[model samples]
Target chain A: MVQRGLLIVLSGPSGVGKGTVRKAIFKEDGVDFRYSISATTRKPRPGEVNGQDYFFVTREEFEDKIQNGDMLEYAEYVNNYYGTPRSFIEETLASGHDVFLEIDVQGALQVKTKMPEGVYIFLTPPDLKNLRSRLVGRGTDSAEVIEKRVAAAKDELKMMINYNYAVENDVVSKAVDRIKAIITAERLRVTRVLGELDN
Target chain B: MVQRGLLIVLSGPSGVGKGTVRKAIFKEDGVDFRYSISATTRKPRPGEVNGQDYFFVTREEFEDKIQNGDMLEYAEYVNNYYGTPRSFIEETLASGHDVFLEIDVQGALQVKTKMPEGVYIFLTPPDLKNLRSRLVGRGTDSAEVIEKRVAAAKDELKMMINYNYAVENDVVSKAVDRIKAIITAERLRVTRVLGELDN
Candidate 1:
């Protein structure tokens, strides 16, 4: 039997560039993992593909999934339900395909409770000072708002303690390289590769 | 203070190409880690540098080190004592330089007892059949001897349970790449990088 694929969760505080890094990882060649497409009740955009983009579903269907525990994690926002379908992830992993999830810290924590074996990676800024500067450099938020955001970022950084790895998003390519290395290394872990020996 | 560097121990069954893989890793540019130099009581061959090749020392000196508990692990062969010096490894790590030890399984187990935090990697052949073929390809051993060697290899393969990773030495460069990735991923482990966050 083929070994189950790894579940890699990438998360961090707001504006730490988790999305950007995840996008870069997918774009890179030789990365063999599936991007988890979330199921959402919101209407699809003009160009969004049904399965390629989000797994668009009706509100009733999404709610039923949540009620039946089919949703790995779900959240309601602006009258729309969004969640990861439990069946898809399980089936994909069973077929020996890795599943990558890019989510927020709170969402990642929820996934962790459900899949403790997943590799949780916290994408951190170069440093707290750098993070604060990036927040301030936005120039869109007021000084008071930036200060509050900085404080919130500090709290989010504390959540990194729960992660298996803390990768610095110092450079997009560098962070991608590190994440790739992480996946490669994880695959070689004795716990994961021992199955081959048994054969 | 600089973070103490990691102690990476690479070992596996005899004739698994651990030494070849290690040499390839060091030859690759951008790979950073000190190859552990062993202390030995045997006289160095011509052109072998004092510290570069081996820390050649008198038998009395080697014995005194063992008495003082300065020898990390050692064994006597052909009436000559050979062992790793504890101080050199400690000093290198304390100075923020990773120390790599390429030793036999027995020596690796001894080092693991002393440094439980070290990353122990077991280099494995692609398969038992392949290992047997390699042994037979030598054309020097009798069939009975080859059979005994394969049996010993199987027992050694069982020791992989104690290692953090089991890398198949199918190709020298691929094995080197996996080892490099292991080091990269290890450097990002939360337990190790959390110290940077504390600042």
Candidate 2:
């Protein structure tokens, strides 16, 4: 089999530590994945380059790409336009490398809609109590804000049914371990890299 | 964590080398797994013992278990009975050991219906050519029968979606390696072994 990268889309509710697992996959496991950068209409923050942090584009350019099929998937958030570019992913896949899309549930669905073969994995919180505790422990939001986040989690849980695989983040390190194993196992799936077996 | 025996169900298409992988898993990896002894209502063969190859029992006894919720799953054919008994599996799981059920897709599904939490894996033929070649090259079946087997295999592929994980049998060693990794990876699912997690 070719040493091609896997187009892995890891999405989960907040506080599930997907970022941590994503970083570990790159640093510890040597995934060699090219992160799919998003193109947004929002202004780039300080020290964030237009093409580096995001392809900071004008509203007209975002609209042109949306009409021209240049983006794999995109959405408007808080009136700010954001989209994943198709050319960037296509280039990486052509070079036989995997691309990682660290996006939300809606973004993942849009991606799946575009790339039916893209592997979608949902990282779930172990339990409700723990998910709530995690939201609180993060110390990033007020109690009322945490309540809203937990409420939003219920809606996210409903979307798990659409995902091909679900990995529980009870222990972030262990979740990372399973994520790696899953990627390894999926690499052996007949539909993808290996294709139909001759033997 | 207590070392509990896993009630493993291995089912896949013919000529996929399921038996070879099963043996290698134990011999090469030294993983402890018991091959489940099936029960039958048929009388013992000329040299067969009741509890060795099968736990031979009367029709009345087999029916009684089915009626009393004792038999795990059973199938009758050609005036003979084949069933998996509940006692042995329950004992094995409780004894901190795992039992390996090498059976067909129907049998695996029956066991899953009885025990939803059991680990389920489906092995696929390495490729369409290897699949057909293996069945025909074996020369155990005539061309007509071989055609029928291949047709049946096409139908079996549909059930791959039902399996928790799918392992493709391309390279025997590679298949075994992924399967070993799967079992190891499953141990980390968290939902499967919550009690084993550190506090």
Candidate 3:
């Protein structure tokens, strides 16, 4: 029997180290899994590549997808378009490889409506004080930028109510371990295909 | 914030090695949990202690508790009564130590109705042939007894639709490890009592 793949949606507040923890999880990977390549109308930054880093598209193409519901989740930001393509995710799922998508709270909610059973993991910082320190420690964003990010965190926390699991990103290793465990546990979900063996 | 324990229910065909796997999991120790004890009117075998192996009671007391909705699940077997008491399970859950219950398939459905979100684990033998081999391997039961057990296995398999997860008893270690991982993963459920921390 072909075992079904789990779709794990990961979201967290800014400065919570989700990127660092996710990097550690995908760092030592042997299994076949697709890291979702989001499409954006915005130009790629330096050192970023099209297709691999993202599926760069024109605003027209992004809007067409949103109109057709080809985008599983999408939102307009800063006069630019960003969205997750429906075809790519379906292909990955059909191939029996679990897929991970790192999206913001808004995208996560949109995906939940389309796929109600997708396991969600909300990444949390160790504490508010630590979160502030991490933002200041980055040294790239200005004080105003840090303040905006903190404000955005408050909005993101409200959307996490739909998340099925939560892990505090205090230590990269521990957080990655917890995320990995959540994936492992999700694979055992009774409604999934591999889990049907006992029945 | 205090974390509440999960209510986990396990059911499987008899002689499929669930007992051995459960024992192996608890042997690691330090993981404090209570295995729910049932109230029964059946006469205790040698070495069995009241309120330990089971809450040995008279038929009148068992019936009284059932009338009062104290028994979580109850069934008549071999002209005797056996059932899980609700008070012990409720107290154990209140103490924040996960309560694990091993009951027959019928009782499992009963427990699931009371706690829909409870984690359910269904154990299956490696295969039907192996199940019979193990049942007969014991050398204590007659051929007729073995046949009856095999028939019961088929009936149990049909009720598997109610389970949330299933673990095959291919090897004792593999089965026990799956059960342990389920428990570990359940601890990470975000919406339990520790849900206040999400803020």
Candidate 4:
């Protein structure tokens, strides 16, 4: 019996290290999940390969996909559109390959609305104070920008109520372990395994 | 703040090796759960301690507990009563220590009615044919008794629909690992971690 694969959506507030944790998860052996590369209208940076870094597309083509209901979730920033394509995820899942999506909190919420069955995981910082320290340590933003970013993160934390699980990203390896456990547990769920049992 | 400990209920059909798996789980390091000792009216076998093996009680006292609703779940077989006391599980959980209950399918269903939040796992054989062979392999039972047991197991397997997880006991260690993963994943659920986040 071919069981449909799980859709794992990982999201968190800005600077919560979702990317680092996701990368670590893939680096580990036996973690078999297809990362859903998103489509974007933004210009690729130097040495960025098309279809590998992203499905780089024209603005008109992206708009056509949006109108066709082909985007699982999408967002616009600085006149550039970035969105998850629905077709690839559907086909991958149909073929019994789990798909992993790493996106921002807003995008995660949008995907949740479109596919509520997906396992929505909210990666969180150990604490707000720790998050602030990390932002300061980055040394990229000025005082005003840092304050604004912190405030935005605070608001985004509230969105965790929409997630199925909230994993504290205090340590990247620990977070990855929890994510792996979640996948293992999900596969054992009675609702998901009943089909296999019947066969 | 002391978070309430999880109540894990492990149940399955007859001859599914629930006790063997539960013992293995406790033998492993880092499994901090307390095994809930059951109160019973049956005479203990040799080498069985009162509090450790079973809380041996008289028929009068056992019936009194049943009358007082102190038994979380109970069954009477061959004029002897077997029951789980409600107080110990509640106290352990309130003290932030997880309690593990290994019981029959009927007892598990009863516990679920009282504590629906408990994580109920149903351990299944790889197949019904395998279960039949296992039953036949046990030299203790007559052919007639083995057939009856197999029929009863078939009926009990239907109860798996009410459980949160159904893990196949094809391999003892694999089933134990799945149960551990279920516990770990449950700890990270958003509903359980929200209070920690607020703190």
lDDT agreement of model 2 with the native: 0.76
How far out, in Å, is residue A19 in model 4?
0.8
Which regions of candidate 4 are displaced past 4 Å? A43-50, A58-60, A128-157, B41-51, B56-68, B128-157
Q: How do the residues B51-158 of candidate 2 rate in per-residue lDDT, one tens digit apiece?
A: 778998899998988888777788989987789998888887878888888778888888888887777788877555456688877878888887887777667667
When sorted by lDDT, best at the front, the candidate numbers are 1, 4, 3, 2
**Tens-digit lDDT string for candidate 4 (A29-140):** 9988999989999999999998888999999999999999889999898999999999889999999999999998878988898899899999987765345677788998
TM-score of each: 0.82, 0.62, 0.80, 0.82
DockQ of each two-chain model: 0.39, 0.22, 0.25, 0.38
Model 3 Cα displacement at A162 (Å)?
0.7
Docking class of 2: incorrect
**For candidate 2 chain B, which ten residues in a row score worst on lDDT?**
B190-199
Pairs that clash in candidate 4: none
Two-way TM-score contest, 2 vs 4, winner: 4
Across A1-199, the per-residue lDDT of candidate 3 in tens digits comes to 3466778888877667767776777885664567988989999999899988889999898988888887989887899888898778878777787888888777888888887767888887666323456778788889988888777655655655678877877788888777777776677665662343422
Q: Provide the TM-score, chain A, model 2.
A: 0.78
Q: What C-alpha lDDT, on a 0 to 100 scale, does residue B114 get in candidate 1?
A: 83
What is the lDDT of every predicted structure here? Answer: 0.88, 0.76, 0.76, 0.87
lDDT of 1: 0.88
